[model samples]
Target: MKKRNLIGIVLLLVLLLGILPISSLALDEPALNSKKILLIDTASERTLIDRMADARAEPASLTKIMTALVVLDAVDRGTVSLDQNITASAAVLSDMVEDGSTSNIVPGETMSIR
Candidate 1:
């Protein structure tokens, strides 16, 4: 009886482990309403969601220039426009280095895409 219970529990765990990832994928990419997203755990310094987050290039104004280019791409695709306001969230700001050069955008502040 004990052996049967253990087997049942193991099977249940295996089924749940297999189903969880598929169920998460069915969330329509988390409904973020964005073309791509990246999420990291600040405490663990580990990546949670890694979709094009590691886009590679030499570090030539990598931060500001890349940011501008993404905004431009969104503009070109008609998903966002130069006149549209985009608010910088805490998550976005968290990606920045406090002592490093910056675009000077404050968290929660809304600015135009242009």
Candidate 2:
């Protein structure tokens, strides 16, 4: 079996073992982070607790949220047309063309953000 499949099965089994939805658990307790944590009640559209949430070093995972927000905002404002092409700037390429992290975009490549 592929490593990904094995990991997925393990995660699925773990999920199945838990009855309560993950989102509910967050409202019941504060995450033990001496660093940073933010809890939001999605159903109520409110923040339950926040602690140094924005003070951390920017992790690569957080970039996806920023990218999603930017894309959503652009879409909502119609600033970025669906047919428009965006060239990967050299700066963006240099930042992404690293071993550990990347957007997997090469320099000079044109991407349709739509």
Candidate 1 residue spans exceeding 4 A from truth: 1-60
Quote the RMSD, in angstroms, for model 2: 16.7
Q: How many clashes (backbone N, Cα, C below 3 Å) per candidate?
A: 0, 0
Top candidate when judged by TM-score against the true structure: 2
**How would you encode candidate 2's per-residue C-alpha lDDT over 1-114 as one tens digit per residue?**
699999999999988869777786675653484567788999998988778878845577777888878888898898887678899888865665355566666678888876
lDDT of 1 at 10: 100
The regions of model 2 sitting more than 4 angstroms off are 1-35, 38-58, 95-100
| Model 1 per-residue lDDT tens digits across residues 30-107 | 556644557889999998887765675335475677878888888889998788888889896788666655567778
State how far residue 25 of model 1 sits from its true place (Å).
Answer: 55
